[model samples]
Target: MSTTSDPAALSQETEQRPGAKTRVGGLNQHQMQEEDDIETVDYKMVTFSLAGKDYGIDILKIKEIAKFSSFTYVPNAPPFVSGVYNLRGDIISIIDLRVMFNLPAERKPEGSAEDGLILRLDELMIGVVVDSIDKVVGIVSSRIQPPHPIFGDVNIQYISGVVEKDGRLYIILDVDRIFAKGKSTTEEAESLSAVVAPETSAASDNIDELKQQTIPGLDGQSSGKNEEELDLEFIREGLGTFRGFYPDGIADSWLHRRYSEWRAERKKQGLDVQLTGEDDADNFMRTFFSPYSNRFLGEDYVEAVKAVLPEEVSKNISVWNPGCGKGYETYSLATVLRMRYPGHILKIWAGDNDLLSISTAPNLVFGADAVPTLYEPYLVEAKNGYSFSSEIKDAILFEYHDVTHTSTVPDIDIIVARDLMSFLHPKQQASVFNEFSQKTSTGALLIVGQNEHVPESQDWQHVGTSVVNAYRRL
Candidate 1:
């Protein structure tokens, strides 16, 4: 698809000249005045195409129309959220209009000048990827009508008004109504956008700085906490659910203050103020269980994991991958080790406490989205999605084991524990660390979660790749 002129360019073209006739969105000066006279209210809308259908969003909602560029993928985001992109200096979340509207995904051929529109929804900037840019139109209030009952699959509420311009219907979207109910938050939309920036020579040293960033999850964590107000009732209800999994002291302090502010801000925006028990439960599970194995290394932390791997290892390497969610980390390490020691006999003991996940781990299948270049060699075309090669799969011993109480995992050369530390109580974490210290021999590599701050009291030496939190048993 060819991208038509953007709103800015279109406006420049339509500006009246001393001797030139002006045209606004294909209308001559006469038609523009006629449109202005028909209704006291007129709207400037930027129209775009999604799956062959033309739709319009209020021009005021758009920050700018951005060219198609590479974006960073966010795992476990809502289906419509394509990813995030850095625009100029600000990061903006890009939402695919095709996916959001339940239309077919549009893929433009290579080297296209433009492929999406960046919108400023409320306080956040979001990119809405479209098939092509259509012209900017001035719609008269008198000509705008309610959506027909037979409108296409898009949710009717998203359509503010419909108009037949030159026998083609243009669905005018209500910006506030469509996004007001979105799971997207002002903070999360901003944070994801903020992750990627143009690195400069002056800032190269600062690039490796370890910063604690929040992962997008329950209670608007993707979006930062809103602090303008506090809702005590909302706080009380959330704390009730939180107390079941975590200590009351935790709920009383940082967690309490965090949720209270978020709930109040969400309430003020007329967003859902109450989280279902399942919402809280899922966050707890991801925090403790490390269910997102594919995502663990997608951040800047992956370099840290790669940096700590041994250049040359024994012909026989025994590895323990705890919190091995769906076997991604287990298989990932096996793939790397196999490449490093192509002739070695690799024995990986991977386990998780979740029975359902452990059962699924052996299959070694993952969604097509997980097939990044690093993971592609081991992943083969599988029935539903993708699976690992037999060579990569057969080396792992998948089991159900709770690491918190496990005492014996002997002769381990390396232990990869990602996202496991942050979930445990401080006492439990200390206990697990102590157990790890006793079970592994000297010089054993122990890798912890990226954001986790392991106790300094433990007698362990920090290995390189500080972002990934790797250590050597001293």
Candidate 2:
């Protein structure tokens, strides 16, 4: 009539029972119970090693596993704090578990990356560095034994439990308790949340305050030129920090115009004009992209692009399309080019930094209704859905490439890089522009984002209409 939570006690009970091994359907009671336990694997842990000992965290808490180095060092942070890393675009603080637990760690060579697990703790994302990452281990929840002081080098409070599987003993870590703010025994432990989450918030607030301040001139009114310039500078910095959008010579004119609009809109809403966070920065620059960015180009957009096409061109038209995400924009452009010059041999070198997107782009398929009418001529019905014709598919070479690197694409007649320059560093933007100038001859067309503008130079002429921001090398 009595029940126990201990697995050892239950096993002992099974041993004491009479006919415990009596077979039913060629399997004993204990053997069947073992199979049932195996089938009920509800808990999954991403197992890893720290200082030669196996440790695990709940799989649900893991966002991803990554290996990267050169984290941007924070000015004042705890010794356990590795630094901040830009995961794609969102910045996350990195913590070294070995350092936090006061354990010996393998010293990686300078600039060498360490294994890391990005954890999604509530709304905050943090990266934890470890010695090595192992495979995922799934076991029954009831098999986990209570944490003991002698089980792991980590504090008992941080250790959730210990589980043994295949001769490997894993120390389960309660990340919630480890990262919980104001609930730790020591001041250093309590500051983990403060260092990771609140510090970023405070930095964002400081940026907002710096942008909101208006310096007064001799006449008592705010200094229009200096204040506006200061606000613009902050906006540029925020765009780069929050979203990696660098508005330098490439998007300077559009940035100025957008700043005026953002200021007026914020004033009308009685809110500060400064970008507060990622969401605020996104809202400020929402109208900066072209009409159809990630999707197929619309009918009007195709016509507008076609209108800007040069009247006379060579028989072999070579085009370079960077940031060709999922090949939607590339396919759209290819369709337009094919229609614009049917007799010309079209070749498009499409490049994107996203490997998944670039790999799947060549095999992109869509329903007939999903694409614009302009793409109807190139549609070929397949088992799954309609895909581009062989001619259109063969015309493009989708490669995983970053535009900041040296491009092997031959001399280009046209470059379609919309909404790409603003996301790169200023120096990178300058380098890409220089490449464009170098690879292109006179009358080569250059199409950028709607809000972006090519810098004024004798080598390039502004030939864009109100619909498209384009230029021509002169």
Candidate 3:
């Protein structure tokens, strides 16, 4: 992409003869307009309890209040994963809070609908199996305080504080900590630590083994929960179910069309098929993605970087760009290295697996709006396909990649993928995270968009939120 226009060139283009009138009219157009004065509104959260104790979580954190039900076990997952049972094709995990909270083993329910409650965080769907669920109550910041040391029954560090409403006290949970306890987190972390450095399950003994139970007939009995007690029929969690809430069909219609189009575009792109999202995601990437590609790495730096990068990067440090579209990110990254390392050597690979984007990249030209406001300062010389001298730049190459296609990544220096997580389908977000983990070697940096997250379970230490973020690979 052309990406950026030289500022000096722009100034030269607009220059006027000798002494031209610098002012247009009496007042500066920019100064005359006042800044937009829009107020930011904060929403209040409601508090509630699970079991007998009072607990408060963001009311928004909840999608719906579902009761408990039997969950099908996901093979080789951690004990915490519980298992993947179908909530109408939405694979939900039954987080055995009984084990988490130090409670006794939980009795499984025999049914399709829930007996306890279902809580979701993005694409990760997990059914929190609780003794019982209380009603929803509202709370504000002023009505909350730090948890009293006395209520130390549930030993969790992520707790934010306590809340009050009408003589009621609630212990708000730190979901960041609670969900961080998942198997995916620790395993991914360990694997990344190994991959970034050098190192990298279907779990058995699901609830059936964890609880030591046998499959009983429909007319089975448990200590407290009951099978065949509730209806086995289910609430179908179809793809567009989330669009149901928007009235007049405006939001739903837009969402439906977007997702449908994306679904179709995915087939056309022929990108690594394993990395899936809403059908619309592929469409979004195919179109909007290429535009952003320039900003990701840009044409100037990509070719220059690769030319000068050090040998360490090429031989060992692989470069990863998560949202690489049209190879602008790839080319710009390579350019940065070449400009720095004229003679040094390293192993670096720039990757993105969008075939159309990749195939179309080298030929595309960028325009001004596709550019970044600033440029990376550290760069020097470049000559051919890629010749570099900077100990920093000699270490990079390019590859076409799709994170969801692999569980492990090659050894690398930095992984840059920006603004992608927010648009990932809510259903595929978490597992797709594994692909990110699989690609790095220890001490490598994993860059992400501002709003994205590494599972609390993964050991992705926060880096920064500049144009994007950088996480220590381990």
Candidate 4:
């Protein structure tokens, strides 16, 4: 999917010429000339139908397409939400695009459907329902044009492009934008207002007391220090408050993005502020660290990891697996390498800030079903559940290391930090990015989160499809 723009871009493109007559005809002379000017590229698209209209999404973005299943409804959720469901013990929210776009409601609320496209975006998994999947067709880039004005009924900004094939138009929908906007439907505003109305007074009183207790220099009334210094202190106190509220998975990037606007409002009013309200914190936390990514051992993602591997497997290689939650990814990588290149020496140094999580890495035990089917050969039945082979255990050296600070990690070849950088602020992200480049060998592979793109200006060159964020060190 491409980067998204606001509604103005849609309006500007849809502006009709003075004598322009909207018709379903072939391309014009100007469009044909433009097509000839550029090299024609083909993108493999998984075409699906909704409300009897055809739409397509990039096949690479898809993790696994499954049949429709029953979901548990969430009360007070947005109108477009179908509800949540437990997919193999992982709870995922389902979104009904039919209702989301005000199309004719054709899908049944409960029952199996033809297909559900499962998308893993930023550690969150969402299943989108469609009537039936057409064929995986190749659409040429030159044939793709800007969104047509007829799509104004649905939100136009979400349409990335339109392609004409076999005298029919296929609208390319940007999944990222659809999920971002659909999560906050119009009904959500009313729901949020009602929930906040009763708590406003009590929250005000608590904020007043908290400011007096937490904000430094507020009681002293000192004037010698600069305002910028005081503002910095205020931010520090705010972050501390947030830490107290959330003990695990707290990222400064998420904190600022979630509350920066509110902080600006407080500063404009010339009033000292405490931390953000409980509601905002709850919402942001839920969005960032969703429960759906429990195993982090999906087959499709593991295959993508395998595809980027260098042709010549080194006899001895070092790898750094940062943010190795529950060591799921750590074990998966070990299994892949062991099977792919037998007798190859592997030295993986996996670490996570979460102490309890990193501590369990040495045990090499996993739930009976936690391990993927392909890696089952490496598992031995244990009293608890299953334990990986000793060979698998010997390949890793798990440690407790925080990437935020200047800490020495083992000289490595590959670094797998998926969905880890998204939690960090831009400053921290850059710090980590530079550190990864310095720590890795020349031409080492960097497999980041699906949507995490390494800038071209940096010392990394993007390899393979732009849809996949795999990079090779320069």
Candidate 5:
């Protein structure tokens, strides 16, 4: 690279023959040595102290750090249930940090668990009481090595990896593993009606009391079950019917209503715990979705959905509905489009991966009252503000296509995926989105969930709130 002719320079050049290793070696040996010594990703093990003792939890696991608030202590609950607090809007549980660390108990006069740091974890929240949380230091993640298997023998089941930093050690907590272990066990839960459900209000108060009086390493719980005590029989029974449809999967409303009523009757007679047959799975699915289906996404959501469309694209549009679960939106969109277009033809190619829906198709008609917000046609009729236009049915068509097999996909002017990606993992979602981008014409619109995204998805323009992201394919 140089036009130098000096002998010393030529010698230097020969010694530093340009390859990755040569260039690396050509650096000031001292600087290169420093570079080698410094680890970026696994820089330094993060070290902090809790309750005057060394404590370390992976930085990634910590969703947030917040000052504790008054919680509703669950009465007669398992020992580990610290309490419940309002987190944003979701009712999140808080775990006592002191109980977790095997440290000296959290001391307070009477009701003191209510005041501490809130440590949020993956699926659950723990309210660990610490004398204080020190600064979060960068510890080399690479340096974190699994401890000898012996660590498990000492209630260290939650310790995932241990990292050494600055001649100090940090303990990494596996919140997921801990949560899985914390669930209630079976036999005691089978007798749960006798053990009694803990009052949510009391759960809060006791958390404060426990915070004041808990012993360090209170591993031996005073309770009916550890988290494993879930009524597996009930769970197994509850999940059975989802494996099959009720009344031959006819998609009959009478069958749907009867299915729920019969299940309720069985549950009242304690027959709910009986797994019976695959027919029960239908009951579970209906029950689970009954609350969420037909729900309104709100005006803001509608705006977000609209924003995903091109501003200049003509009003009457063609939409491809992938995984058009029960055609709620397929029909809803059909309604609005028919209303908006008057005479312009609006074609919707609605498909779902589930063959059962296609086999037992309604072709028209949506169950009203459930998710009453999303299916506005029902709401309009109920409110006496509008009447159904028989022409709306002509705008929609439902079909079946497995997204895993992308060849069935058709070219469309727009794609409305709703909450479709939520069920798929990030990688799967990304793959599907990639497939979507390819099939879509440039400037084609794509609609996705508020909580989901198309990763490495910059090809689409960010034109709306993420709750319902709308994109224009580049």
Candidate 6:
């Protein structure tokens, strides 16, 4: 049978088959069942255009849709391999689908980004560059007919199936088959290798020169000031590139110390010292965060924080907690502050750049077992779990706000920005510190990360013990 763009024509053709009912008003049980099966949509696909033809991939395979450009070039890669791209923190390989299928691709202007889909294939995340991304289309899985050689421009083996919807014929692609390993053909195997090879090879190859320059002690004596000041510079860049973490100002000392530890550990394991990927970058900075980060504060941590609180403050205590992820740290701080100053009117402006985290912070619930005993006084039992009582919850406000941008928060008595400054660039860190200085008054308390130190200034005095890295605004 010939393929047609009209779904109605295809339906009529199916009805004309042997034993199919041709009645208009009166339909048989078999015809009614067939119609019901066709109407039931069980599969969804993210549709896109390839060389002016409609195509689709299973929505379950897609991680996200993005439009990005300027991927880092990999040497000696396959012709179809578009250079690798930094997807947030992870380094993912990019493939040009048009080039892979030998289809005519539209020439884009210089530095223009192409539309792509990030696919989560097993443990790997790969981005495929396509002509244009269309809307998601849902259709009955039963309606998808077997793919024929005449239906698609690419190889019939790569096409999973074909389905007609809204006068359009969509060729469904089998991504697993296309990118699978150990293909029968030599050419196909090589192509598959090109996709997975970057996970081990490309990252190391890209930073080989930096690795060579790095010495055991990380002293910059080799190049006589011509090279990087320290071997940690490369790690710093990788952190910024892969994890958006910058080790400047308050984090500089920790970065240096962590480099020594990282190098020693890698040597003990007989592994390369350089941070080759996002996983390595994360491992390198694992110990840099404060205790109980992104979780409820424990008894020890709550006591350590309370010890740093000033003896005297105004009746109306205003606090600014930036990077308050999911309001865990915020709720923990609220409980601590309530214990510290029970009579004062507590107001906390908790802000985070993550929209999902901030949006759900107000209604966050925790299991009875998960919540610490320190928060029992302020806890309210819910149907599913326990949430903060009105006395604790009503005192804080969560907003989806970027810390780098201008905020309308009032003058603060305490600023809880633990491990937040290190993630920003040097210029951004300076700007934020300047804002902190302006927003806070004298004798106000400031809490930072364990490894981080506030930029040494006469205006701020170190008041924290070894357990807490805090300063009082002078």
State each model's CA lDDT, in order: 0.65, 0.83, 0.49, 0.66, 0.53, 0.83
Regions of model 6 farther than 4 Å from truth: 1-230
Taking all chains together, each candidate's TM-score versus the true structure is 0.42, 0.52, 0.32, 0.41, 0.35, 0.53
If the candidates were sorted by their TM-score against the true structure, best first, what order would they fall in?
A: 6, 2, 1, 4, 5, 3
Model 4 pairs in collision: none
Write candidate 5's Cα lDDT for 119-163 as tens digits.
Answer: 445455665544556656676566778854434212354677777
> After aligning candidate 4 to the native by TM-score, how far in Å is the CA of 280 from where it should be?
3.9
Instruction: State residue 348's C-alpha deviation in candidate 5, in Å.
Output: 0.8
Over 165-270, each residue of candidate 3 has an lDDT whose tens digit, in order, gives 6677778877656786567578757765565432112112232342344334333766323321121101012222322111111122334344445545555977
Per-residue lDDT for 180-246 in model 6, tens only? 7554467775754575455334434534655565553356455643233455677778899999998
lDDT tens readout by residue for model 1, 1-474 = 112325566456556442254324544566658756665444677888877788988777876777766777899988788787878888788888776765556456655544778777668777888888888777666788998644644656568889877678898888776666446455544543353222222133332331112212224643234222233334444534664343222123434444556565666978765555666445433433332455423423444466787665545688988878777678777877776678888989998888988899898666878655776777789898889888988889998888887544545778888766545553465457666665564566888654444455345777846355678866
Off by over 4 Å in 5: 1-300, 314-316, 340-343, 364-390, 425-428
Supply every candidate's count of residue pairs whose N, Cα or C atoms clash at under 3 angstroms. Answer: 4, 0, 93, 0, 46, 0
RMSD of each: 22.6, 23.6, 30.3, 23.2, 25.7, 23.8
Clashing residue pairs, candidate 1?
91-193, 187-223, 188-222, 188-223
**What shift in Å separates residue 147 of candidate 2 from its native position after superposition?**
83
Query: Could you tell me the lDDT of residue 451 within candidate 5?
Result: 38
Query: lDDT at 401 for candidate 2?
Result: 97
Tens-digit lDDT string for candidate 2 (1-474):
012224477667757654655535445766778878667666788999987899999887888889969999998898889999999999999999987875668889999989999988889899999999998888888989998756535767789999998899999999988887654446654554455355445545654664465333323565677777778878988999999998766677778888999999999999987899999999988988888888999998888999899998866788999999899999999999999999898999999998988888999988888897878878999889999999999999999999989898876889998999888886566557777876676778999998888765666788898888789877
